[model samples]
Target chain A: MTEGLSEAGLIAVVCEACGAPRTPIGPGDDAALVIAPPRGRQVVTTDALVEGVPLVEGVHFLRAHPPEALGWKALAVNLSDVAAMGARPSAFVLSAAVPEGLPAAWWGAFARGLAACARAAGAALVGGDTVRSPGPLVLNITAWGWTEGDAVLRRDGGRAGDALMVRGNIGRSTLGLLNWLKLAESGWGVDGAVRDDALAAHLRPAPPLDAGPWALAHGASAGMDLSDGLATDLPRLAAACGLVLEVELAALPVDPVCAGLTPDERAAGGEDYGLAVLVPAEHVGAFIARGFASLGAARQPVGGERPGVLWRRHGAPTELAASAFAHFSGG
Target chain B: MTEGLSEAGLIAVVCEACGAPRTPIGPGDDAALVIAPPRGRQVVTTDALVEGVPLVEGVHFLRAHPPEALGWKALAVNLSDVAAMGARPSAFVLSAAVPEGLPAAWWGAFARGLAACARAAGAALVGGDTVRSPGPLVLNITAWGWTEGDAVLRRDGGRAGDALMVRGNIGRSTLGLLNWLKLAESGWGVDGAVRDDALAAHLRPAPPLDAGPWALAHGASAGMDLSDGLATDLPRLAAACGLVLEVELAALPVDPVCAGLTPDERAAGGEDYGLAVLVPAEHVGAFIARGFASLGAARQPVGGERPGVLWRRHGAPTELAASAFAHFSGG
Candidate 1:
C-alpha cells in the first residue's frame, strides 16, 4: 500500500502472503533453489491474447465489457490448458498492456477478477507485468502446475480400440454464443439468464477441473479440452491416439438449444469448454457411471474404433463433411 | 524451430529442456502447486512497456529494434528487481502482444532474446502467453527470484553512519543516450560501437548479477540500483535509511565522457545500471575494496554522514542547486 516502494518492496509483501517452503535459498538470492519432489513433474504453459485478433471490440464481447472479465478470461483460458493436461493449477504470472489514462477502477476490477479466478482455481496470482499501449488491450497468462503418477494426459495417447467419451453435454456454450449473436443482430436484448450464460461462456469459461482429475484417476487413455468445437477437437484426439474415430451421429449429445440449429452450424460452432476422454472399450460402461457421478456429466461414447467421424441421426449413422472448426475458415 | 506449435507447445519443449523436476501435486491435475518455500517469505514484481510509450517507432532504433531485444529488455528490467534484492534469480514468464502480419522473424527473435536473458540470469523461461494485437508491440516480463538469508538488503536499511559505495561508473549509459539523441536530431550517423552501446544499454541492460550476492555475502546494510539518476536514487536511499546522504560531487565518479556536462545534466542523467550500497562504518574500507574488485569499479567515499548531497568544486564542498531526476514527475 505504500507509495514509491520499489518493486522489491512489493515483492516482499507478496512473498509473505505466499509463504513458500524454505530452501537453502529463497527469493532474495541470485537464483532461487527448490528441492524437487520425488515423483511429481513440473508442468508449465502460456497463452497470449491480442485485443483485435482473438477478440474484436464488438464481436468477442460488448464494447462495455468489464475489465474484470477481460482479466478473468485471460487467466481462465490458461487454466483451461492445465485442465487439458489433467494437471492441477499452481501459480500464475500475468502480463498486460492497456492504453494509458485508463481508469484506476478498471485496473482494480481487473485485479479483482484475477484474484477471483485464482481463488476458484486454487492457484496464486504470484507475479505479473503491466505496461502502457497504444493499441487494443492485450493480456498473457503463464501458469505452472504439477502432477504425480501416470495421470498426466496428452493428446497423443489415445489407442485404436479406445471408446470416445466426453465429460458433459456439448453445444450449450456454442448455443449461448449463437443466441447472443442473433439477439445482437436483431436489435433485441435477450433475457438476463440467457445473456449471462452466453456472456459467461464467452468471457469466463468453466474448465472441467473435476473431469480432468477424474479421467486421470479412472484410466483415461487420452484426453483434451473441447476448445475449438468437437468437429475439430475430435480429430486431434484421434490423430494423437494413432487411429481414427468413427463418431456415431445418433449418439452425439446435442444440447436442446443446439437442436434447432443447422447441421453445419452445430458441427462448426466452438466455445464448448468440455473435456473429451478416450476410455478402453471394456471400461466404457463403468467409466460412464463413475465418471458421471464424479464429474456430474453423462460420459457417453460418441465414436467407435473405425477412423473418421460418423454422425448418427434417426437411429442411423451418417458420415460428416469436415473434421473440425477453423477460426478463420467458415464451416 | 518448428512452426505451428502453439505457445503451450513451446513451453512444454523448454520445460523438458530444463529438466522437468517433480513439482508438487498441483501442476498436472487442474492447476499448479507452488509450495511457498519453507519460509513464509517471497518476493514479487512486474513491469510493462508499450511500443509507443517508452519507444517511438523510428526514434528508438534503426532497422526497427529486433523483437528479440524487446523480449530481452522486458525480462531484463524485471531481473533488475531481483538484482536489487541481493537475491538469486529463478523463474520468469513473459506475456507479449504483437501486431498482426508481424514477421515470424520477430517472434523467433523475441523468443531467442527471452531464452538468452533467462539463461544468462540463470533463470528458466517457464511459461508465457502470446497474442496478436492491432497496436504497437507490448511486452511484460514477470520474474521471481529469492535469497536464503533473511537479511535481504532493502532501501530502508541505510543508517546515519553508513558509507555510500556504488558499483560501476555512472553516466556512461546516459552519455550514450545523449549521443544517440544528438545523432538523431542532427541527422548525423555515428560510429557503430557508440550506437550499439547506446542501443544495447537502452534495449538489453546488463544487470549486475554478481554484485547482489557479493553485497549480501559481505554484509551490506542497504543497497539498490541506480535506475533513476544518482541524485534521485540517493534521496530514496536516504529516505529508506532514515538519514541524509551527503554526496561529494567532486568525488562522484561521473564517467569521463560525462565530466564536461552541465551540473544539472550530469546530476539528473540516468540509465547507469550500477549497484549502490550503504556499507556500515565498521566495514566501510573492506566493503569498498571488495565491492570494487567484484564490480570492476574504482571505489571512493563520496561523502560522510551529512544531511544532504554536497558537491566539491576546486577542493571545497559546495551545495548544488538542483535535485535528481524524477521519472514520473518529469523533473
Candidate 2:
C-alpha cells in the first residue's frame, strides 16, 4: 500500500532532512527568524511562480521534473536575488498549493531538494503554508538575508567608464533548453553526459553564491545576475546606473557549445544564471588578480559606454541587436 | 485604451491607498519590518483560503464580493489568530493569485478594503505578492503581533476543572451563509439591515480582537477563536488542553438569527469568529466582572469533564456528533 500523507506530513519529512536550526522559531510558529548581522542591513525579496507563465509542465521542465529539483529551483531563484545584494541568505518562507492526492514520495523528494538547497545556501527553512489547489502546482518563496557593512551592491551605481564583467560562462541553460526541445521534437537520444549536464543546467541553474561578496570586496560599481540574459540585463544595469553601455563585439565570450548555434539562437535564449557587474577601471586589474584566480576566469570587458552590445564575429566588431533572454512584453 | 498596468502597478495602487509609507525596505525588498515591541514577544499565525473550499463565487459572499473584502478577509482571519493569542496585530504579508483580466476596479476596491481593514486593526501591510492564475483566486495571509509581560495565552494551558467561557455570540457567520444561500435559492430578497449585517458577517467577519488581550490580562487559561464554529473549534481547544470540554447547551450564546435556525442547521454550520477560552474557577468571577462585562456578557459554564464535547438540548445531555466544520474525520 502507498503511504497516504497529507501536506503536513510532507513538511515534517523535509524539515527532518534540513537539520540547520537557524530559525529560533521554526515551522509551526507563526513566523521564523534568522539572526541579523549586528552592523549590516537585512534584505528581503519574494517571487511567485504560476503554472502557465515561467513554469509550464512538459515545457519549462519535464512533466516529471524531480520534485526535489522543483523545490530547489523555487528557493534558489530567490536566493540569487539575495546574493546579488551581497547578502548571505538566512531564512525563507514558502507557500505552496498542490493538487490533492499528489504522491507522498513526490513531496518527500521536493522537500529533500528544498532542504539541500537551503543548507547549501546557508539558509534555514523558516516557516510556510501548504494548501490544496484546483490548478497546476504553485510555489511562492520569500527569502531574507543580511549584509555586514555598506558593501551591498545595487544596479544603479555603475559609472560610464566602469568595465563590465560577468562572473561565469553564460548560455548553458539556454542551450540545455534548446537540446531538450530538440530531443522532444525529433525523438533522438543524446549522449548521457551531455543530456545530464543540459538537464541539470535547466533544472538547477547555478547562481554564483560567492560573486556578490567578491564584487563587494573588490569594489564592483554595480551588479545583477543575468537571469534574463546579458543583452536584456545589461540594458537594465545601464538604465539603473544612468549611463549608456558600450560593448566591443570582438571580445564577446560565447560558450563552446553555443558556438555551433545560429547567432540569433545564441542571442535571445534565456536562463544563463551568470553574474554581471561593473568594476571601476582602477579596481579592474586587482579584481583580475584576486577575483579571477578565485573564480577561474580572467576579468574581461564585454561592454563599455557605447550605445549597445557589440560582438566580434570572424574578427570584426558588429552590433548585436539583442541578447538571448525573455522579456516581459505583456504576453 | 485600457490601463495596461503591470503587476507592479497594482501593488503601487494598493500601497498608495493604504497610506502606509512604503518601507525604506518595502515589498520589492526581501522582507519588511514595522517597529516590533522591543521587550515583548511577537505573536504570529497564518491562514489560507482556497476557492472551492472556504469560498465559492456567488455562494459564500456574492459574485460581486468586493476585491477589498477578499483582501480584508485574507488578513482578518490571520489577525483573528493573533487576537486569539492576546496580541495586538502589527504587520501582515499577503500572497494572492487571481485570474487575468480581473477588473482593475475590482482590484481598486480590494485594495481599498484591505487598506481600511489594516488601518482599523492597527496593522500595516508590510509586503505581499500578486500573480495571474488560471483558476479561482487563492489568498494566503500571515499576521504578526506582539504582547507585553507574561500576557500571551496558549491552547495547552487549560486545567481540567477550569470554567470554559466564550466571548460574544456564535454562529452568526454560519447563519449569514445560510441566509444568503436561502435568498439565492428561493429568489427572495433580504431586507436592507438584515442583508447588510449578513453580508458584513460573511465579508468582514468581526474577530474578538480586544477579548484576546482582555482574557490574557484577567487570567484566562486557554483560548482560541471560533473560525471553525463552536462545535469544531471547542473540541480542538479541549483536546489541546487535554481536558474534556462539556459545553452546556443552555449557555451557548447563539445569535438571535441562529436561535431562529433549526438545531441541525445551527449545529453543523461554522464561521462564528468568537473567542472561546477557559478560565480558572477562582478567577472566573473577576474575569466576568471586569473583562466580560466591558466586552459583552459574563462567562458561563457550559459543560463538565467527560471524554468529549457533550451538549444538553431540551434538558437532556448527549454526545454532540462531530459537525461538518470538522472536515477531517476521527476528531
Candidate 3:
C-alpha cells in the first residue's frame, strides 16, 4: 500500500519547491501577492488538459506517462500562449481537479516538474488550488507575462504579402501519439531513440520560447503558438487577419521522426506546440538566418474569397484535409 | 431536441458578452493583453467547482441549480479570495470542462451570470478555455486583483490580542445545502421564502467584497475569507500566527435559516464565503459599527501549546465539533 499525503501536505510541498521568487506573499494564504508587471501590459492565457480525450486515447493520461510530464505539459501549454504573445512570463496560478487515491509521490514529482518549467521560463508558481473530483483529473493553468510598450504580438496583425514562417518541428507530437496508441493496441515497436524522441515530443513539448519576442523585435507582424496543427491553426490566423494563406507544402521543415507521413497528415497533426509567425517578405532572409522555415505567404482575398488556407504542392494549387480537431463537435 | 453550441460558438458568446473592458487585446488572440496593475502589487487566487461534491449531495450540482447560479458561484468564490486579500479584482480567466450535450441555453445563462458578477466587482472576464470532458463538469477560475502599497491582507498578520471577527451570515451555505438535500431526500420542507433564500445562499454566494479592504485600511491585523467554515478556517488563521483562537459561540452571527442547528454544527459548516479578520481590541467597536460581528480573539499559548482553537460558552471553556470539511481526505 502506498502512503498518500493529505491535501495540506501536498500544498506544503508545492509551496516549498515552486513558490514564486518575486512574490511578496506566496501560497498558504487566501491569495498570493506578486509584484505587478513593470511594463504596464499583462499577457494572460489559460488552457486545460482533461484526462483522456487527446493524450492517451482511453486510459488515464496521468497513468500513461510519468506524472511529471503531465505537469510539465499542463504549464508549458499555457506558457506557449504567453510566448506567442511576445511576453515574458511572470507568474501562474493552477487549479487542479484531481480524483482521490493518487499517490503522494506523484504530486511531489508534479510540483518539481512545474518548478523546473517555471524556472526555465523565468516564471513563478504563485498560487494553486486542488480539489477532490469524482471524475478524471483536470489541470487548468492560467499564466501571465509582461510586455513593454507596443511589443506585444497578435495573430491578427498580419498584412497581405507577409511570409508565413514556422519555428520548431511539425507532426512529431502526432507521431508520438500514434506510436503510443499503436503500441497499446497492436504491440507496434520503434527504435529506442526514435521512441524516446517521439514520446518526449508528445509528453514534454518545448515551445519556442524566445522566437515570438525575437520575431516581434525583428518586424514580424503576427504570431501564434501552434498547439493545434498548422492545418487547423493557420486558417485561424488567416481568418483573424481577413486574408488567405498560401502555403507551399514542399517547403515545410518536416521532422525526421515524422518521415514517411504524408504532407497532409503532417500538416494536420495536433499538439506540435511550435511558433508560427507572419514576417514581411523583406525580413524573410533574416528570419531564415535565425532558423525560421518559410512555409508560404499571406495574400489579399482573391475575387471575394473568404479567409482560409490555400495549400500548394509542387508550386501548384492543392487541397488538404480539413482540421479534425474541433472540441465538443465529436466529429 | 435541444440544440447545443459548438465550442467556437461558445467562445464567441463569451468574448462578446464578457470581454475585459480595459483590455486592449481581448479574446480571439492566442492570449489576451490587459493593462497591468498600476499599484505595483497583484493578488492572485484560483478555485474550482466539481460535479458531485458538497454542492448538491449526490446529483450533478449544475443540474440541481440554475446553470447561471453555478457560474456565478464559481467566479464569486474566486472573487472572495481576492477580496480577502484586500485587493480590487481586475480580471479573471476561466477554464471549464463540460460534457457533450449540455444545451446552448445553459452556456448562455452561465456566461450571463459570469458577466453580472464581473460587473459587480468592476472586473473583467478577460479570457477562457472550454474543453470536452468524458467525466463530470469541472469549472476552474483564476482571478487577479491589484493592491497598492502595503494594503494586502494575510492570514498570518495577527497579533495575540487581536479580536477575531466575522462579516456576513454564518452557516447560510450549509443551511442551503442541507435544505437542498432534505428536499430531495425525504421531502422535508421549508417555507417558500426560506427555501429560496437558502438555495440562493448556496448557489450565488455574494461575498463581502467591500469588507476586507475596508478592514485592512482600518487597521485590522490579519484576515481571510470564511470559505471552509469558522471551525476549520479560524484555526488556520490562528496557526499561521502561532496563536490559539478562542471563540465565543454564543456570540456567533449564525444565519436565521440555521436557527435550529446546534452551535457546533453552525461553526462546523462550510461555504460561508464571508470575511473573517483579526482586529485590534481597541478597533473592534469600529468594525462592529461597520457590520462586522465579534466572535472571538487570538491569544498566545499558555504552556507549550500548539496553535489551535478553543470554544467558550457562558464565559467558560467548552468544546466544539471539529471541522468535517476536508478536501481529498474523503472524511
Candidate 4:
C-alpha cells in the first residue's frame, strides 16, 4: 500500500492469498482462460458496487464493516444475476480500485474472503485487476456460467398460464438491512435471535444457487432474481412474458422479521436474492417434485390475460406501484 | 448527469450509444456471452486506470481531454496484452465508476469511442458495469482472446541462444507522450503537423495487431508487448528467459525526436506497445520474409552469458541502470 510498492509486489501479496488453482490459466498471464461448453452458450453478467451508493451508513452497513463482507456481497450480487439466468457459475474476473495507504492486510482479508466465497459457491477466480486510485474503493465483478442442462433460462422465455412461484422468504434481506442501519445509528444492543437473523440476511445474502439449476431441469418458463424488491422486479418478469403477474400476498413465504409489514410493503422491500419464477401447470408436479424451496406453491399465475403486476389479497386484485432501490438517485 | 437520473435510465442511454450488434450477446441480461473456441486456450488480462496515475494533469493532457481518447486508451492497453499473446482478441468487459454530474453526453461519446475501437481491433464489447461513485472516475477492462494456431506465445518460452527482434518503433509513443505533456503545460502553439502526430500517438496508440499472429507462425520463442518501457521490460524478459538481453543502440527503432536522449532514458519511456520478441536462429529468414512491420532482424542473443539488460554502444557493452515511469513512487 506504500507509494514505493510496485504493482507486481501488490499482485504477489494478493495472489499468495487468492491462490486456489481454480483454472488452468489463473491471474499472472496476459489473461485468464476459461473453457466454454462445447455445446451450450455462456451466461454472463457484470455489476459495479460503488461506495455510498446502495450501502449508506444508516441503511446498509457501517463504515467499519469488514472487507470480507464487502468482497462477498460484491460477487454475491452478480452471482445472483447468473443464478437468475439458471446457469451454474463457472468463473469470474474481479477489478478493484483502492486508495493509497490502505493496509496490505485489508487486501489480504478481502482476497481470502473472495477466494473462500467463490470456492463455496462452486465458482473460481480466473482473473482480476488491482490499482491505486485517489478515490473510494470500487469493486466490479463479471461472472459467467453454462447451463446445467439443455435449456438456458431466459427472462422472456415464459408463456401465459405459467404458475407463479418464488424460492426463499421474501423481504427478509430488506428487514435485515433496515435493522442494521437502525442499530448502527442507535448503537443499541442486539435484539436477540430475530435481529441477528435479519442482520445476517442483510449483511450476507445467499443467492438460491440450487433453485436455478433445478428450474432449468424442472421446466421453469421464466425466472429472475428479486434484487430491486419483488414489486419492482416481478412486474418486469410479467412484462417480459407479456402477462399480468398476480401474486397472492398470503402465499409469500413472509419471514418472521417482516411480521408487521403490509404485504405490498414486503413486496417492495429490496435485497432478497431469491428467484421469482414462472412454471407451467402441467409441470407443476415436476417443479414441486424437484424440491423447489421457499415462497412455496401458494401463488397462481393470471394466465397473462393482462399485462402488468397484480397483487391478490383476499381474492381482490390491485395494481402494484413502481418502486426500486434508488442507488444512484440521490445527491 | 443530473442527481435524480435513475441507474436504469442511465444504462439505457449508455447502451443505446454502445449498441451496434457487435456480438451475438451484447450487454444485457445476466451477462454478455462470448463464444469460446472449441479448442485452444483463452488469453485474458485486466487493467485498471485511475484519474491521476501514469497521466498527470499538465503532464499527460489537459483536464478537458477527449472522452473518446480515454475510452480508446483504456481498451488499447488491454488489447496490447492480447496482441502480445499471439491471440486474436475475441471479447472484453468494461467497468467504470463515474462521479455524479458527469454528463450523459460524455458517456455517449465515451461509449462511441469504445465501440469504434473494439470494432477496429476485431473485438466486441460483450459486457460492462456502470455506477455512480463518490469518487473520481475509474475504468477497468478485462479482455480475452484465442490463438489462431496451436502455439500460445508466452513471455518465458524462449531459449538462451535465440535471436532478439522487435515488431515496431519503440520510442514514438514515449516521444508522443512527452510532447503532449510538455504542450499541455506550456500551451505552446502547434509545432507543425508533427506535434499533432505525437499527440495522436500518445492519445490513441495502435498496437500492431498482426505482429502477434505472425510471431506465432514464424516460431517466436518468447514475446511480450513493450509496455513499461524497454529498460524495465527488457530486463524482465531477460529474466524470464534466463539470459542477458543485449540491444544494439543502432538496432533500436527510436523516433527522430528522441535523437538527443540517452539510450537508457529512451528505453525507460513507457507505453510504446510494440513487441520485443526472441526468435530461434533457424527461423530468422522466415521472420523477416513474413513481413514484420517495424523492427527487422539485426542481432543474435548471448546464450545466458549474463543475467540482465546489456546495451551496446560504439561496439562497447554496458549494463543499463534501473529507470521507468513509476506511477507509485510518489513525492
* Winner by TM-score: 3
Q: Rank the candidates by lDDT, best first.
A: 3, 4, 2, 1
User: Candidate 4: RMSD over Cα atoms?
Assistant: 4.6
Q: Give the TM-scores of the predictions, in the order they appear.
A: 0.72, 0.77, 0.89, 0.87
Better of 2 and 4 by lDDT: 4
lDDT of candidate 2 at residue A184, scale 0 to 100: 58
Cα lDDT tens digits for candidate 3, A1-331: 1247666676677776676543236677889987764554788999877787444242326454567777777888888889889887888888877777777777777777787788888888888887766877788889988775656888888999999999988878877776676665654343222337777787777888888778878899999989878887999899888999999988888577778577777788888888999999999999999999999999999897999999999899988745433320121
Sort by DockQ, top down from the best: 3, 4, 1, 2
Compare candidates 3 and 4 on TM-score and give the better one: 3
Give a tens-digit lDDT track for model 4, residues A1-331: 5354465666665566656353226775555656556666677787777655344331222234466666677778888888777788888888777667666666665666676668778887777777766667767788877774456666777776778788865777777666765765766344322336666666667788778877877888778887877777877777667776667776776467778566666777787888878887788777656655323222334554556676777567655433323321111
Highest DockQ: give the candidate number. 3
- Please give the RMSD to the true structure for each candidate, in Å: 7.4, 6.3, 4.0, 4.6
Q: Quantify all predictions' global Cα lDDT against the true fold.
A: 0.57, 0.63, 0.78, 0.67
Candidate 1 iRMSD in angstroms: 6.5
- Candidate 4, pairs of clashing residues: A30-B44, A31-B44, A31-B45, A44-B30, A44-B31, A45-B30, A45-B31
Docking class of 2: acceptable
Please state the interface RMSD for every predicted structure, separated by commas. 6.5, 4.7, 2.4, 3.2
Give the clash count for model 1.
59
Model 3 residue runs over 4 Å out of place are A1-3, A13-24, A53-62, A105-108, A186-195, A321-331, B1-3, B13-24, B53-62, B186-195, B254-258, B321-331
